[model samples]
Target: MEPLLTAHNNEATSIAQLTAAQQKLYQWDKTIAAKHLYLIENKDTPYERLTTLKKHLAPLDATRQRDLIARYKALQTPPRGRRVEEWLRSWVEITNMCIAADVPETMGSRAQEDFLVACRTINPEYGTSGLRDLIDLEDAGTAIPSVEDYVSKFTTYLKRVLPLSTGLSSMAAELDVSKPQQQNKDGNKNGNKTKPQCPCGLKHY
Candidate 1:
């Protein structure tokens, strides 16, 4: 808890660069945006899907709320030698964003799983870690002025937790190979070998 701002600055820069996590989150973000989630919430087209997403996200969201409440309660008592939660605005936002990005992750879809699976994009210069300090006196904390402070922290958090890639690319690649079409579920026409069954144990020929 080095002043909420500097807690993570010493972290290695490489940790902030997106490997596959940001790509995943970007994909989910695209899906959510393309569907216009808010507009379709009450309509029939995307309502069910959006509702399902929210349902899946509820527990994660609730846990974040619960964590805040617990932290608040802890602050009221004032731990003898620890950083207070009331001053870690950036820290709070970062934690919340981590949970927010986790929404797509629990759905079990390949895109949701891989997209932004890790939020490695948060750089120190603009992130919240530069705001909070380690000293815990009763003095008030510095108020973050620029919007970039919040944006950097949350963006990095979102990217890190974002889902992995949509697996569609790999699926498409597999489909692109020119394998002889199975004449039927029974076997290949040339009789080299029978077609492999799908995961469901059913021949998809």
Candidate 2:
């Protein structure tokens, strides 16, 4: 006796009026609804009489169903400034939506493939080979894998790749060159005196 059968009076309540949680509990997608309707009508299950009596309930709204495959196809990978943790949080949100919508395309393998595809677009030089090179490099010195290995490894890869992708290496070189010039200016202002030792008792010179 599932709660869906006895919890509510069908004559008084419509399916559209059911809460999202209730719809999920009853597995109320279109295909599932059809199957259940058929079973109820044919008196196929031992609970057939109870189900048939409630068969007049309204169907879930077709428009409320999401096309998860299409949504993922259109999903853009977050830009470099966005942390991988934020991106993963967003993916988790999407997964919850898919489960609520009863989307069939939300399998873990499909998610992993989609994640890889999104990541490849971030660094096309990786050439979409499942990020093998980047993964291997990140894992090179690590002996033990943890539950968060996937996130940690991918995060390290992004940190390494984003600098290259965003011209940060050249920017860093320019900054490095400017530092000597600024130091010379400061040295002149100080009349060529050795700078005072740092508070930590270390001399920069």
Highest TM-score: which candidate? Answer: 2
What does candidate 1 score on TM? 0.22
TM-score of each: 0.22, 0.35
Locate the minimum summed-lDDT window of 10 residues in model 2: 165-174
Summed backbone clashes in each candidate are 32, 0
The TM-score, computed over Cα atoms with residue i paired to residue i, of candidate 2 is 0.35
**Cα shift from native, residue 25, model 2 (Å):** 18
- CA lDDT, candidate 1, residue 177: 36
lDDT by residue (106-200, candidate 2, tens digit) is 54344555565675655454436655643664568533232134444556765564444343222223334324444455456657855688899
lDDT of 1 by residue, 37-155 (tens): 44333333334556767776668666876665454333223222222222234334433444455533222222211211221222233223333321121134533233334334444
- Quality of model 1 by C-alpha lDDT: 0.37
Off by over 4 Å in 1: 1-28, 31-45, 81-205
Best by lDDT: 2
